[model samples]
Every structure is written in structure tokens, then in C-alpha cells.
Target chain A: MENVTKTLDAKGLGCPMPVVRTKKAIEELSAGEILEVVVTDRGSIADIPMWAKNTGHEYLELVEEGDVLKHYVRKGGKTTDKEETPVKTITNEEYLEIADKGPVTLIDVREPDEFAAGHAPGAKNIPLGQIDKRMDEIPEEGDVYIMCRSGGRAGMACDTLETFGRKNLIRVAPGMGDWNGPIE
Target chain B: MKVAIIASNGGLFDAYKVFNIATAAAATDGEVEIFFTFEGLNLIHKEGLKQLPMPEGKEHFAEGFANANVPSIEELVGMSQEMGVKFIACQMTMDVMGLKKEDFADGTEVGGAVTFLGYAKDADITLTF
Candidate 1:
């Protein structure tokens, strides 16, 4: 029964929203403080715990009162930083410089619609979501370049690829949004 | 990460928000599933493209989005599917709404509350739109 330093009313908010709001709320609390969140979304039972685990916070407990759920979370003294991926990154200009120099494996991590809407010519569509299932499609030996709309998804893809023993991967950061190159 | 989205609203804006979040989650390598129930089932129907309309008083906002190059709800659904976001239509809702399997989009799957709850049970994040 830790003292609640703050309370978040996340009732009626859905997935991501509750977690998103909880994250912001937790930031305002001091280390070792507890934050109580009341939510009506049944999904929050799983969401809040997962979010806490991923972010290195302690998920204390949750109590359900009729339709409302009350979650207790203990803030970690220091928020754990995400692990650093070994993948290297390149600028859009740098990618262009090496685009036609030789054979390069460019993996577009954007959704197929976005890829179809416009993408760097000759780029292969291996969206981030399908990466696990499509890992075999990636060549074992090649200059692998991953790009997304911005750099976030590409970074995630790189992290996933790294877990699969991919090394020396290159991330096309600040991706297609800034690309002035030709589109497919 | 396993993410489940429960779409219960029929408004075009709500569907748009759901798809947008679904696609973004998929892009982040999250296992995303969108369950269409109640009025939300209309979003996956074959006729959804023609039937989707902005909620009352929000009709004017649609034009703003169109002018900004935002994709339509249909296109967003396509994007969500392409990004590996699973689309599930509620069987109970279909029965109540008089919708058949053939009435839904090509990739839509049918399931009941139990099925959705199973996914939600293991999901890292669950949302209802």
C-alpha cells in the first residue's frame, strides 16, 4: 500500500492512449513514488503492465471495481534507457551517393500503401511488421539499407534484424520524408 | 509487442484513427490486430467505402484532410493490411447486423467475443475505438 503521489484518470481512453497518458503522468512523479490509474478499458489490464515492463517501471497491482480498473505503478528511480542497436545510419544524401554505385539491398520498412504511393526506386518492400516472417528474404551477403517514412520504424527494424544476428546494417535515417530522389 | 484494437465506432473519423494507429503499431514491429464490432463492422464491409461518412458536424473536416493529401479510410485499411495488421469482423455483430461473410472485405476474418478476448488476453496493448 504505497502512498499514491499522483492519480491518472484514464477512464474511457483506449489502447496506446492510456499508456501514452500514463507515461506522461509518470514523468511528473518522483522516484519510488506510486501512480494510480483508473481506466474503463478492459485492455488496460494487459497494456499498462506491458508498458511498465518495457519502460523499466514496476507494475504493482490492479484492482477491478465493477467496470472501472484501478492500476498501481511504482516509478523506477531512473527510467531505463533503450538498448543501443549496433546498426549504423546514413543520411539520405549518402544513400543517394551509393545508390547506383553498385548493387545494394534497400529494404523499405513502410506499409505497402506508403511504399506504393512513393518510394526510392529499386527498394524492396519488407515492412517492419512482416520482417519476422520475411527475414529469410533478406540476402545473407549484401549492403543492407533499411528505410522508413521517418527513421523510427527503420530503427526498430534494425533492432529486430540485429537480434537475428544481422551485423553492419545501415539505417537510412530521416527517411523518405526528406528524400528528394526519384520515386518508383 | 502484441496490440489489439477494438473498433466499435462507425464514424469515418474513428475508423481513420484506428487504422492510423494500427499501421503505426505494425510499422513499429508490433503484432497488431483490429477487431471490428458493432457499428465498427461497417468499416470492413465490401460496401464500406461507399457508406463511410464523417460523423455529424464533421463533414467539413473531410475536405481539409483531402486537401492535405491524407489517405482515405479505404486506403488506410489497405495500408493497415499491407503492414500486417490483422482485421477481424465480429461474428455476433454480423449476425445482429444481418451481414454475411461475403459482405466483408476480402481479407476480413470473422470471430466472436471469445476470439477477440483471446487475442486481448495476450496483447501487450488493447484499445477500443
Candidate 2:
């Protein structure tokens, strides 16, 4: 049994709650410390590990006791810096300038319906959630620019692509929310 | 940050707020969960798209939003789910309202007060509307 620095009782909570409580509980611990989360939401079995991976925490183990689940996570000293990526970002104005100069690969990471509602003319629709499984769909050779309703999902997509060694990625900040360009 | 939202109102303005905040929080890596009870359950009903708006005082704003290409409540709900925000409908409320599992939009789970309370207890922030 690992030394438990703290324990969060999230039993009966569903979906994101268990993960949410675990995140806060982990924050209170010091580097290399351990946090235990007990939850009854079966979704946490997958959610916790994904959250740990996304946030760069160590998912030590999961123990199922009866209908409850005990998850052990080791606090990472540099969790805050783990998500930092070297991807470059460009302003919407700069993106428009570049697009006007020549054809640019613009990837809209919003949902299909959102994309259908309105999107930059000639932009490719590859939603952020499906980016990982659909990476191959993105051309390896091009100046790839990503955008969402806002710049947030685009930033996340840039980080995800960076991890996969995809360079030449540029994030369009102040995305569609402030896009003055014509929509398709 | 962890935000637990208890939405008990079916009003469009309130539903918009719930979806907006939930999606925003998720975007910033905050874990978010919304529990819909009482009238709020109507927001997730299959026919919710038609009944989403408040009955008064917001029609012009709603029209403006539509014309501006702003997302509707249904679209916002979809966006929130894409951002990993969890939407849960109250089971006891469903029973009282004669709603079944099929009555809600896809991706909604039915839960009880205990389940929602469990979430609120551990959440860093909790709000009711």
C-alpha cells in the first residue's frame, strides 16, 4: 500500500465529478506525494486515467473494493508545466494575411454542426475530439492552422499535435469569435 | 477547478448560462458536471430545441443570437459535451415528471439526489439555478 497523503471520497458522483475532486485533492499535496480517490462512478475507471495522462500525473493503480473504486495517483512536481507545448500561435489578422497570400490549410476543431453552421471558407473540418484517431487525415506537408469557436480548443489541438512530433503547426488565436473573414 | 452546477430551471436564459459556463470551464481544463432536476430536465428533453427559450423578455436577444450565428442551447449543450462536461438528469425528478430514459437527449445519464450531492460535496464550486 502506497503512503496516502490524502483521500477524496467521491463515491456516487458521476462523470467529471470524481475526476474534478481528484484534481483539487492532488493540488493540495506536495511533489511526489500520493492522493487516493474513492469513487463509485464506473466512468472514473477510464476518466481518471485520461485525466492523469492529460494533466501529467501518475496514475499509480486502481483497486476495486465491492462496488467502490480506489484510485492511487502520485502528484507530479511539475504538473503545471507538463501541458506546455512549443507550438506557435498566430493572430486572426496574421492568418488572414497569410491566407490571402496563398492557400493555407485551416483546420476547424469545432463540432460538425458548428462547422456546418459557419466556418472559414475552404477550411477543413477535423474536430479536436477526433483529432487523435484522425491525425492521418491531416496532411503531413502544409502550414497547418487550427481554430475553434474560440482559441481554446485550437490551443489544445496544437498541444496534442506537438506531442505527436507534428511541427509546422500554428494556432489561430481569437478564432472564429473574432474572425472577420468570409464564412463558407 | 471543479464546478458542479445544479440546474433546476427550464428557462432558456438559465440553460444558456449553464451550457456557457460548463463549456468554458471544461475548456480551461476544469472538470464540470451539471445535474438537471425539476423544470431543468426539460432542457434536455428530446423536444428541448423547441422549448429552450424563456417565454418572455428574450425573444429579441434570441433572434439576434441566431442572426449573429451564435449557437443555440442545443448546440451549446453539444459543445459542452464535446469539451467533456458531464450532463446528468435527476432520476427522481424524472419519475415525478413521468420522463423516461429516452426522453432526454443523447449522452444524458439519470441519477438521484445522493449522486448529485456526492458530486457537490467534493466539488470546489457548486451553483443552483
Which candidate number would show the highest TM-score if scored against the true structure?
1
Give me the displacement of residue B85 in model 2, in angstroms. 1.0
Off by over 4 Å in 2: A1-184
Residue A69's lDDT within candidate 2 is: 94
TM-score of every candidate: 0.44, 0.43
Please, what are the lDDT tens digits per residue for candidate 1 over residues A17-115?
566568678866544557899988787788788778767789999999999999999887532112455568888999998986876889999889889
Candidate 1's displacement at residue B76, Å, is: 0.9
Q: lDDT score of model 1?
A: 0.79
Runs of candidate 1 with Cα error greater than 4 angstroms are: A1-184
User: Candidate 2's error at A28, in angstroms?
Assistant: 30
Pick the DockQ winner: 1
DockQ of each: 0.04, 0.02
